[model samples]
Target: MKKFIHEDFLLETDYAKELYHDYAKGQPIIDYHSHLPPNELAEDKNFENITQIWIEGDHYKWRAMRALGVPEKFITGKATDAEKFQKWAQTVPYTMRNPLYHWTHLELSRYFGIDELLTPESAEDIYAQCNSHLKKPSFSTRNLVSKMNVEVVCTTDDPLDNLSHHITLAESDCPVKVLPTFRPDGLINIEKVDFTDYISTLSKITGITITDLASLGEAAKKRVAYFHENGCRLSDHGLIHAYGYDYTEAEINKILSNRFAEKSISEKEIRQYKSAVLHLLGQLYAEKNWVMQLHLGPIRDTNKAILTKIGINAGVDSIGDYPQAEQLANFLNRLNNSGSLPKTILYNSNPSDNELFATMAGNFTGEEIKGKVQFGAAWWFLDQKDGIKDQLDAVSNMGLLSCSVGMLTDSRSFLSFPRHEYYRRVLCNILGNDLKDGLLPHDMKWIGKIVQDITYNNAKEFFQFPSLVENLSLKR
Candidate 1:
């Protein structure tokens, strides 16, 4: 049998094949947002086996394995790495029509040069082969990034994180620009039991005694400044919906004082506090010219039992049915009215909000900026082929697709870089089909340039990272 993933994989037409090969295939990736650990890149850590690098911290694979009746021991438990690989291989063939099947084979082919379908039958050989490759110096984390032609990768970071690893990467000879993105969900989530503890930690970090809302904002601003100096150009927030509740500065201060005193806070008070903090941070991000990314609509940690056992982000989350439009508009309008709305990217986990997010993004475009408020790439559960097509259609129909920044991994695994290629193929196929049907002009050069822009150039210009721009200039 021919390889499932070949040169023409996912390219259905001659135009599709031509566009992908000529315009999209060789473009360098700019993963402007992801959950990749910076310390691994800073240390150039090499995995001892494929499972260590691929299975660990990958909740997608773990979720699939659990669906196939694999026990936690094999998924994230005391099973040996070899056993986990066996369980994953056993689960692979059953994942047909799912994105994992394609991702698994693509990673195997792209990284290990092994195109054989992963199965219980072929598991041993493939596992051994991947392990052998892992032992090579070229398979180290930094080399893997270079192998994928990644120009820049911005890792999500906590506001209180020291970012010493990011500092190390910046000062080292590492080719890829690994920058940090400020993620202050902890600060925004005041309803959590450990909120005061997190505030205390932040106070210690900034040497600002957190006694009131003003001091809290002062400490947050200091951290934002520190992150900007350390090459951070983005801030990310994870929320079920936008917090746009109305409240005065006095009300927010009272709420913070109550929380600090270990007193009960009403739901209205919680929303008010969150809105105040988010609004304050939005202005600060604008001051520093940093992009703010809002990842919305996921109801996280639903399975209380599993969460208690595995902690958070163990794949128990699902797309939430939140009323996003009104609050989202209110928040953005408030920022825009204040003239402090930074360049923002809105990502929706629920597909029902596709056109809503697309049109909403179009609401706040800057005269000098192209697609300033962006409907970000299909995210989380929506990063698959069908979800990608739907998001692209929404952007093309409701907004400017050509001006939009393209795909990002948003993944923790180094091997997930082929997701960009997967997205590119889908993109070329869409445009190529339009050309074949006479829906678009037959000018390949013009369309090809647009494809190249969406694949690479758009993000480079949209983000405008100093080090990334300088490095790409040197290469030119």
Candidate 2:
């Protein structure tokens, strides 16, 4: 048998190997979406050890360790960093057939030059070696980003954030362009307990009293402009599903007013309010030429006790089973009718919606742009091997795969850049396998260009990030 995760790992044929090594590997990453904290990059923070960087804030590993019967102490509790690393190494072998197994070794090899598999016996030496490297200036957050050949990073940010870190990076001669993405989930989900308080915070920031939907729209527009001034080119929304409920202006105004008055609104009213706000934001996105991303189908924080203790996004979330097609299509059509549909990307956390989303993406392609409306890469719970293949198949069957922009880490970890590499390998393998089976021609030059486009070029062209748009044109 072949060696584990060799240079041609996942590549089963000659075409696959060459496609990855020659065309896909050296391309710079445009990490258009991630949760990497800007302050860490701005301060150029260095981790104290492997666990600090790899274990902390990574819910993927937490979920796996929890599955292996690991206690909270070693996962996210008061254990020492070394203790956490030991627990993780012990859990690694059990992760075979899971994406984490590949990601773990890929990161170790790419970032730390460690080739041996992680296990309980090797944990101590590996931890010590990583800790020693962490102390070096080259391992600082900014340097780590540079080392990955990342061209741009768009960090998800709330509308109320001051974006001081983005400004700081812009002023420095930082190698990568670190920009902000406007994520207004708090503002959109008006039924949350913290909704009024979040609005109050936005009111304080914008000097606009958000007593009605109109004022809320005004406040959001102001923040959008602020984000644009700070070089933001994208906005993201996370929802159970897209909203399309129709509500009159008076009805929406009353909903917001009652919400601010500490009155209870029904679930239907909640959806109505959310739909109205999203449509308003879509108009703003179109006007500002910002790309809008919708991440749908998550039933979050299901374990109430764990949620009560560790809070949301503690890896207690699961895919939601929502009826996505009708509402999603309705929302897009509404935006299209109003000429307020910006360049859009739809991501489905539930695999059942993959074909639906891929088919729907074609219904809204803009005349001014190629692949103006896209089905985004597999996300969150669906970022694994089967999920990736399913999404690619759906998009290829129903949409323009050649014009599709590619993957993002969608992660909170710096080591997550290897995920992009993983996606590239999977993509090349799919294309190469077809060629080897006589389903595709052996036109290496054309196939190679398509791989490069998906790896880096499409995102560079799709987002038209100001820092790199000129370069994109030159490269083309």
Candidate 3:
């Protein structure tokens, strides 16, 4: 049988074989952004069932389920694992031309060591086999990380987390680095239900009263300090648009005052409160030298009933028509003027925002690798072939591909690591084709080296990997 993955090298034509061969050699992965849990890595947790690992928490499958008209019961509810597997297999072939098709097959090939495509006929057997593997002690989360060749993975987390898990992972002798990304978008989603609990939690975490803006700020500062102590060097924000309403600090303090009074705020006032909170967070990030990433412009929760039933991420998100440049101007202008901006990487879902977001990113000279500004690779629903190509082109044509980190999994699935290899192959295919023709120089060695650097080496260098510098393999 043919190997699903090849080690021979040079996935390009013979003319460019030597170059691609040299370029595709083994390099450590820098997965700087992901939704994976830190505690799972710390615990080296293993899944009990195939469904538990694949269907339990993954929103990708949830989206497909909604698309296929499968009820939520079979997805995240009472349906048996076997029943869910059956539904998924029925939908698999129809996922044609979707990235999920490739990812599912790739995972099957790589992890389960099964080359055959998953269909109704094969689902049960494949599920049984993979379930068996999932139960093995060697198949724990940390083991999965090692097998995926992940050197560093940053998981999205709250400022209030104890980070005990992150500390545990660091203390373990594991070579893979599991870090945290501070996601404080919760502070922006201030409704009565969320705000009350958030404040209570913040108070408990920081040992301070979160009654007013000052107290809230103080509590958040304590959380950020704890994160830093545990090796968190990054923060992330998800927004509908980069719009942050303008207001005087005193006027903003009034909302904090209102929240303290337990009074309901108008929708417009909520925007002001969020904007003020954003500026505060931005200042904190810069003060601490943390990387900040923004995922902007998802018209989220379009399916109103589904949203009401299931809460957010119910596969109802679509592209928003919000003003791109205009929406971003106010907030970015604040950061730019105050010079309180951390290293910023912006990801926008709307294709029209491509140029605007890229140019806006260019203005910051910011974060991670620093000019201090950078644009992110395609993300979420936009993490597709065409979207990725557009992002690479836009960044390369507008910014510098040399500074661009290439791709991040942004996944909840351990099996999704091949998405990295997929991105790398696509990059090589593009670059190789360019060099094969006359668009790029025919100096295979330099071109290949650059490709390798972009695929993995650059990511390793750009993100905070204070631990890896001690590794002897880093010298070469």
Number of the top-ranking candidate, with lDDT as the measure: 1
Question: What would the TM-scores of all predictions be?
Answer: 0.98, 0.97, 0.91
Best by TM-score: 1
Task: Please list the Cα RMSD from the true structure of every candidate, rounded to 1 decimal place.
Answer: 2.6, 3.0, 3.9
**Per-residue lDDT of model 3, residues 82-108, tens digit only:** 899888887888887788887787777
lDDT agreement with native, every candidate: 0.93, 0.91, 0.76
Once fitted onto the true fold, the runs of candidate 1 whose alpha carbons sit more than 4 angstroms away are 469-476
**Clash list (residue pairs), candidate 3:** 343-367, 365-371, 365-372, 365-373, 366-372, 366-373
lDDT per residue, candidate 2, 1-476, as tens digits? 55476899888899999999999999999999999999999988999889999999998999999999999999989999889999999999999999999999999988988888899999999999888998999999988888899999999999989998888887776788898999999999888899989999999999998888788899999999999888889999999899998899999999888988999999999999989999999999999999999998999999999889898789999999989998999899999999899999999998988999999999988876989999999998788888898999999999889988999999889898989889988999999999999998999999999999988999988897886433211100
lDDT string, candidate 1, 353-458, tens digits: 9999999999998989999999999999999999999999999999999988999999999999999999999999999899999999989999999999999999
Better of 1 and 2 by TM-score: 1
Cα deviation of 231, candidate 1, in Å: 0.5
| lDDT measured at residue 197 in model 1 versus the true structure, 0 to 100 | 97
Question: Model 3 misses residue 423 by how many Å?
Answer: 1.1
Q: Give the distance in Å from residue 335's predicted Cα in candidate 2 to where it truly belongs.
A: 0.6
